[model samples]
Target chain A: MDFSSKLLENAVYEMSQLPGIGKRTALRLVLHLLKQPEDQTSRLALALENLRKEIKFCENCHNISDVALCEICSNPRRDKSMVCVVEDIRDVMAIENTSQYKGLYHVLGGKISPMEGVGPQDLTIASLVKKVKLGEIKELIFALSSTMEGDTTNFYIYKQLEGVPVKTSTIARGIAVGDELEYADEVTLGRSILNRIPFENSLKAN
Target chain B: MDFSSKLLENAVYEMSQLPGIGKRTALRLVLHLLKQPEDQTSRLALALENLRKEIKFCENCHNISDVALCEICSNPRRDKSMVCVVEDIRDVMAIENTSQYKGLYHVLGGKISPMEGVGPQDLTIASLVKKVKLGEIKELIFALSSTMEGDTTNFYIYKQLEGVPVKTSTIARGIAVGDELEYADEVTLGRSILNRIPFENSLKAN
Candidate 1:
């Protein structure tokens, strides 16, 4: 769309470059900033700039962090020998929120998606393999999603750790908790039945 | 939600301040930016800062502009005697895209909405009335939205222009173009019938 000011146009263009934001939405957002105090925009800009320039990643897990080692990786209480592998930091956050597991996480950055030109080399697979080879981790849990890309990345890593004297396992896949059985997808329902655990074990989980 | 890095949290917080953006969406957008090249975030931050710091408003119509006088106002071909009063620059751009009107625009910044603590004094209505009182404009067209706040703002401006030598009018309310009459709302359909123009006049509009 035509804009009256070059400054406004430039701002809208840059905003629309973000994922999921279109031109009209970007214009609306920029106009909103104009209506707010000038300090708001300054703070937003400063925060983004500082995050990009100074943000760090955990040396052990490759998770986003403010220091060399993220809080989860550095915490002594967390089970360092039991590392859960995930696609990104968001998954790490999700598991952390549940408070169900006390293990450390190893962020893969992303899964192996050949369609997007992402391979095993594009992620932190090498570092994880090195950690396992060094005999630091006793067990590795594949907590990636159940998608094709996720399965591919998990298998790739599993192959890398062949005969490394480390136990390997995957997260369970079944109908979500609190979901109606009638509405569950066929594959998930079938898997839930096939992988059904003992009633006492399920009771103990809760 | 918890963030691994303080910088990431601050950026997400500022991003979520934009209208319609929630915490989860803000996190997704921030993470997307992190995955992209560093220059992308820097460009977005710089553009927003420059726009907020260097933006200008037209001295004549109060529309966002890069100069003292907007292009539309400074154009010799535009009819200065006929002004279409609108809520903001977005409306100005929309009307300009129609190419059906060649008159100048008077942007009021926003409508009078007491619910939002917005008053007529907060807008550019006084300058428009002063312009009408100075005999610079012969016709004043109220093109604001049909909401309660829009009508209140229109009536307030009309009252301020009382006893002035200007003719006041408002944009017509009717069913949108290409909309089926069977699906038209009762109020719009009734108003369209009551305010029907001659067939020849309708033909002339096209």
Candidate 2:
């Protein structure tokens, strides 16, 4: 960890501050940047600076965007009545890639993880509640992960919408589409069986 | 791989350009940066910029440095007659950490890798040869990794130093200090046996 230059040390230290990158990895990355053309480093630094300073979050869904409202939230074709609530923008991108969901998304930013000192207020829960109270959304799908934190966040939001006339539901928990039943976890397999849709209804989709 | 924002996409793309980092990991890192305070991003960018713009290479050894001459190259106590040639500054740092070597280092910047289109001319081999030709160095130790490229680079440099009044040696290739014979690779184990040192010489070191 003995750096020959203060500049090199500072660069590596800052790079190592990133998640999952160690000092060695930071050094390697910084060395790589040094090896590359100066333009590459300039472009990378500019992109990161611009993204942090100028990037916007969707006012409606809180998803990362270039403008006040993201493309998804502003799109007229997307179903506004059914809003899929997610933990973050990554989840939104994951769902969008599937092209299966026609409804809109409401990103929670993160779950209610008391262990990390991230409570309900830390997320966009209040805005979500206000959106639901406006009565524009008919169905609020809880698309958060099935962890304890995810469950807590979902329940907290559900409680906030008490008697608000919104039909709250959670995403289906089951074996993935192409996964082998034998390899499925016990809880997921059990839930898949318990929540099995009618054979005719399943056939209608495919 | 569709990004919600152009700025986010650019940052992720630039990040993914780093060795071993893919799109998913880049996205994760960019999102983590976004969640952190804006100062973190600014400082990281600034450090990288400053490092790239202001970094210097030692005039004597070509090691990355803040000034024309690195600390090792300028140190009066170091053995100027015995020079250890290495692949890069990382190797220099690794050897320095051992604290066993008192000789100066000559960083070649990189090995001669034909597969990667890196030739001997691309490195500081010519300068090293010039230094050796000047008759200041009594011995030159090759400390590059034991790979085809490393061997090629070493041989190339050795050929360049032909007829020069200097001793040429390579770092010992053998089983690690504490490695078990049973688990050691056959080549290393065999080499270790073939190049066994005198019992008295081994006993001299702690």
| lDDT agreement with native, every candidate | 0.88, 0.87
Tens-digit lDDT track of model 1 for B26-139: 999999999999999999999999999999999999999999999999999999998988888887876676566778999998989999999989999889988889998988
Off by over 4 Å in 2: A175-206
lDDT of 1: 0.88
Best by DockQ: 2
For each candidate, give its TM-score against the true structure.
0.92, 0.92
* Cα DockQ of the candidate 1 complex: 0.80
After TM-score superposition, the amount by which residue A79's alpha carbon in candidate 2 deviates from its true location, in angstroms, is 0.9
lDDT by residue (tens digit), candidate 1, A26-55: 998999999999999999999999999999
Q: Write the per-residue lDDT of candidate 2 for residues B117-148, one digit (tens) a residue.
A: 99988999999999999999999999999999
Clashes of 2: 0
